[model samples]
Target chain A: MTPFSHRKADTVAALGEERLISAIRRWLGDVSPPAPLGIGDDCAILPASKKAQAITVDPVIYRRHFDDSIPPCAVGAKLLKRNLSDLAAMGAKPRAAVVALTLDPRTRLDWLEKFYRGLAACARTYNLAIVGGDVAQADKILAASLTLIGEASGSRMLTRAGARSGDWIYVTGPLGGSLLGKHHRFTPRLSEGAWLAAHPEVRAMMDLSDGLAKDLHALTPSNAEPALDPALIPISPAARKLARDSKRTPLAHALGDGEDFELLFAVRKNSNRASFEKTWLRHFRQPLYCIGNFVSIGKRPAGSIDLNAHRGYEHLR
Target chain B: MTPFSHRKADTVAALGEERLISAIRRWLGDVSPPAPLGIGDDCAILPASKKAQAITVDPVIYRRHFDDSIPPCAVGAKLLKRNLSDLAAMGAKPRAAVVALTLDPRTRLDWLEKFYRGLAACARTYNLAIVGGDVAQADKILAASLTLIGEASGSRMLTRAGARSGDWIYVTGPLGGSLLGKHHRFTPRLSEGAWLAAHPEVRAMMDLSDGLAKDLHALTPSNAEPALDPALIPISPAARKLARDSKRTPLAHALGDGEDFELLFAVRKNSNRASFEKTWLRHFRQPLYCIGNFVSIGKRPAGSIDLNAHRGYEHLR
Candidate 1:
């Protein structure tokens, strides 16, 4: 028998990416004093002496994240923007980034130069420096990964674990149908995220990458779950158009399509969501939709509000 | 014509990884305040408020860095160790790491569990936490990237550009034949690097990844270069054995075979090399060898001391 033959036949493909991530999360148990957040958040929060720093690493691969139809520049920009979106979820100001790219030998120098140009354009807007990175050769696929560092303001870093039972959840911008290629072009809500992070009432936060149905489950405490109102989910115009063309429910798409890249956060129930949304709209052009409230675990809502029971896109399978 | 076909056909595989890296270094420009070292070094040096934080990201892909003969655990360990070796080169103490993995769907669950176990074993020795990471699916290759964060103890973090003309060059342990599979098991020189960092005499430092012949050029200033006493190079027992089997010179393998992962550093001319070596032996069991000295640009040493003129392992070629 082969060396690995003793193990079970179950593979990551069988267990799925979500289960694999959860397994990893369980393996890396708790953080010490200097680290605030660990495996389950958008970014790993660390105590950098005087200030808190949120750091995250994200990777995009050819054929998996994007295809030949997408420009190389967009690929580069998306690599940086994904990490920036993580920082925004933590309510941190994007500071610097280090990128690592493994390219197929056939990748052109012109393509690479344009990729860096696109990455620089996105990084410059937030004063985020492209500090350093590595370039190596791969067999067939081209993959890019970025490690982003951000500093927390107001002496605290927002996390997905702090939402209370009565906290109201809101998602910045509409969700769903991001698979239509906007996933590569969507701007990270840096200013809006930074503004929300400094505010005292924003309880818990995270970016919506895995759709509302799955990601809302991440925002509330483990012992609790979100009770979302079906009608309130702000379906994106793109999502609506796709829904009309495909004869699918836009609400279902909004909750399960994934890759929305919008901030999904919670505020205290008494903090006046309407007022905050008004101020948010004035400060930013994006719309904010109040989608749900946290409820005790095993407690089902009485009316039409749906429990976040649907799973989003599971990558490995 | 294809969308990417309009540009010149100079591809990464044609120009080579080293030239591409050089072009990228030039494109990144200089590091600003709060970032001590950038682009060219193994780790990007950043100021974490009062302390210096050395950050690095490295990626290893299957069919490129490793194959099925190696265990999955070693793959995980090496991914983290490569980044840790970068931190060691910076004379920084490993604090934490974030990992990102892109796996082929066929990758077994047991392989992943063992992989994390190996990573955790290495991380535990240095009190480094496995903070966070992202997981995605790839079509064929399995790629893993690690982002390591280390805190610099001394006020000034080390870089590859501090060597003076008369400085003595030294390497920790022997080099070469790492491709025979020792590359997966080579331990990072973390303790020794941290100790060297605390002392004021060590001039410049970097880890040897792409062989001594090529990496030495990175140590010297732009106008200067290294003049090596080729006979003095410390060849590893493994390299010697491999040399005998292959009917090749061990010296050539030592100078050209990459992935040594040993710390190659410089000491000021005034410092006593014998005394420092004795001290290094006492603190760490590894041997340190003084192999060369820096010289003025265009100046040739007495007999044939190959002036770092030969290119080493240019990936993608």
Candidate 2:
């Protein structure tokens, strides 16, 4: 038989809905505690929680998000991790997730099986339960949307709106040039975020998906603008390497190249930064940098970078 | 200007991401109690609950679920209602929701605004909060995925695994020919399902999406088979009308046509049928039909219709 015919026999269309679902369940393994109901039911039941819950939905689509160059396992892990990054930004612990997938009928069953395996591995590592999901056929393009539910670490959940003027802005690590494999494999700063949230001095926080030049706007109050010290901004090595071939500067890539997936937060300016950095180093190995502060608009420090000059990636542009 | 130029000026690409997001937020209106966070945040926070929570995710894609013939408002409402049906199946009350949308750059901004308005209306009617959302650009098709979270009606939550050998099968309303408008306009049997769940006689329940001919297998036990009565099947007038233009019989359409969005449940064999029906009639104006009962696998009722011959809609087929 030809390769096309052989692959056709292994396609999702040949497997049908029931069998495909069965395979997906097998690939996902088993549902654990905190989730009394899963997969087979119309809805998954989550155990009651006393902590406030945080929920976010994010989807990854073929061509738009990734292409065939990336492994299916990485694609699945990235789908869950992107949502995990959102919860981390809110200082929440992963709990349960439901995935909705739209796939082409010609998709190979093995590809999907591998994808679920990757997702299950990520869930296992994070102590999350893959509770339920829905699957449907698409004419073309495969997309997976993941809804992650998390419980706040404490009564205080971090948000992007509480930053005050003069708050010192910090990022968990280096940024930019995520397209060089880091976009698919980087770790979410969950513990760092939760620890920062528990700290009284940290006022507002968000994860960086879009570049700092764009995402910083979310933390800036109406009366203030973010003033960054270019020398202090930790530029990724990959970004510098990519800058060699492109017309843009390394600073431009650090400012405009999106998909950084790092934790960005503002701390009270009056707080002792030296003491806080010491405490953070003791608890975590990740590099932490205090790059800037929020200042009154039109009063930015001399020699500070102009944010509007470097725009980050925007969808549907 | 040409019609194409005028339309292009109003496309999402022209509106840009920030303006489009602002319009969506405006269309959604406001966030209320239980959900302290919405639209602008990385994650939406929901107040803690004492009761177990039900969660489900469902999506509607351009050619797969609908076409241009259906108004954008109905399409948006149907997306939420489809997920509502899943929550209703478990006897849960709607609480918070997060939506993730993927749109083509060429899609008109007005179409999206109206879609969000319809979603907002549905959310208001159901007392649900439209929490966080993510938007991404797609190459061609437009798709929306909604994740709905709900609390169980009481300590008890109905599932599809509780059916017994002698349980009686019933549906909340007529079935079939949902394409005639009911698919987009059908009322999710939320209150009726909650009532059924509260009743001690009710054993198992689910919303009928993939017609009884196939979905009945979910409630069938290993040792028992569902024996449905043809005479008692409540085929809709729409099914009869559609049958005239199609090759299938009205009964076949009733058996196999999907998207009914009606509740199907099993009641105890020994429950007082007269008293139960009386209570149902007193509370709901909708018709409740006792279609049949679960019987021994090899011992179906004499002259019972053959279920094997009629197949329901299945994705990726």
Candidate 3:
């Protein structure tokens, strides 16, 4: 038999996930795009005739991100929602998406149909079309990757770069312990993002998928450091319940447990915070919390803050 | 172990590829996007303020699409090239792309770097950017899903729907036997597609990915049937060689083998064929062949053409 006959035995576990990602970034980092976009942001902004378009791609894999117990429709919905959240972070209005499904040969056709229907149901709410995509076969695990395209004026688009030292950091909802199930069903803050994009006070924005501790680094400028108050962190009900059953603090889960899929944004400190809060309450029934403020890195203990930031959810143990 | 723990064992082969794709189209088919685009085309056209943006996504899996013998860079290049071919089919100028990679945990970091470097080299030639993408871990196979975005005016874009009974069928280059290796290195006919799109005589267009026999159905309108001349089929040197070694005829390989990544398009029979041919010769040194014409389904023996059209590469046996 040829090498391909048993190629399924070869796996990617050897090099580890983080290293593989870094290698990819290093390889593609030099090709300067038409737009000034890079690999690290939630979405890459493209140059357009009228408004900048934001594009992002993400894949959800079987066993790793989900399992058989989760309905196939929920799987489809989560993948789409994750990409939508990326666009939301950039304050772009998602217009369309393409999904590529690479499935293990044993997947059921009925399950696949349910998945697409679920994705369609979610997309209908936003009026985003599922335009085109490709299908292929994988050997063992099934995976689906969604690429979302959205548009926004350049000035209105948000990124992790513009936050100043005195900017106040806020979150659209409570965070932590999303793995309990909320991670698959949570709605993306599209409307809130659209409103924030138009507001002059919003400085920097990103989705809190990898937990506040890790994603915070993406939003903070090199000259500044995030000074989040542990006591001020609003823990989710799931996190609170999980904390009650375990020795880990709810704050730890709030700070480190990833997959919250909420909006973490910074606002200009001098902006009308009170009015903004009132307006936010009037617009969304969801609770918003002021978590912390950005501070100059030189003013804080370097090693301590660095250690705290490095305490990402992945390394909770 | 939980169901999630053993989920990697589940495969998609049981459902088959075509059925899975059908399920996807059924579920997402109802979304009335802001644009008039739908799912069955090579690329989904999005309405932009000044132009239409074409988007497509494709995934290349280890072993299935390629093996370790093909260099990592070639693997990366092939994945991007495939997506580029889809854009080319629409006569769109590819502007940017987002790549999502799900790697088998054992994949080498160096190999991943080589793949990206390869993709960057190809992107540089077209002035396309590797804007953004995501990375995740898979249990077995290393797969890369690329979402490419391109632009063209609405009138300039091409689709498979415009072929009329009198339109002549043409292919930019010879086809077939890509499994011998051309599938990994063939360049997409972007320039040829662009030229055809600009020509007022071209009636319909699409790329030949899944053998000319199967893809022809996608290009032929419901009111018409394709009547291809087997003798006129331009067999690639690779296909000719494979046919000589095997029992199959070169024409069979040309019609049934896939992944040519060449443009298969239609031109109006009454158009200036001579001038268009001359212009094509001037722009491209590659050979162009006119092998067939569309006929009304009632004008031909239904069973005779059905057998020929059903000679899809996947069921070549």
DockQ, candidate no. 2: 0.82
**Model 2 superposed RMSD (Cα):** 2.5
What DockQ results do all the predictions give, each relative to the true complex?
A: 0.16, 0.82, 0.16
Q: Write model 1 residue lDDT over B189-212, tens digit each, in one string.
A: 888888887877798888998888
Choose 2 or 3, whichever is better by lDDT: 2
Tens-place lDDT digits, model 2, residues A1-317: 11112366888889888998888888888543322367888899988888889998889888877787888888889999999999899888899999999888878777787788988988888989998888988878689999999988766899898899999999999988998989989897788888999998999999999899999998898999999999988999989989999988899999888889999999999999999999999999876899999999899998888998999988777
lDDT of 2 by residue, B8-119 (tens): 7878889889988888888888643322367778888888888889999899988888888888888889999999999889888899888889888888877887788888
What does candidate 1 score on TM?
Answer: 0.82
Global lDDT of each candidate: 0.70, 0.87, 0.70
* Segments in model 2 whose C-alpha atoms lie over 4 Å from true places: A1-6, A31-36, B1-6, B31-36
Candidate 2's displacement at residue A91, Å, is 1.0
Q: Interface RMSDs of all predictions?
A: 13.2, 1.1, 12.9
Output DockQ, candidate 3. Answer: 0.16
TM-score of each: 0.82, 0.97, 0.82
How far off is residue A242 in model 1, in Å?
1.1
Off by over 4 Å in 3: A1-49, A153-155, A301-310, A315-317, B1-49, B153-155, B298-310, B315-317
TM-score, chain B, predicted structure 2: 0.96
lDDT by residue for model 3 (A214-266), tens:
77877787888887766678899999889998788888788888888888999
- Candidate 3's displacement at residue A176, Å, is 1.0
The candidate maximizing DockQ is: 2
* Quality class of the docking in candidate 3, CAPRI style: incorrect
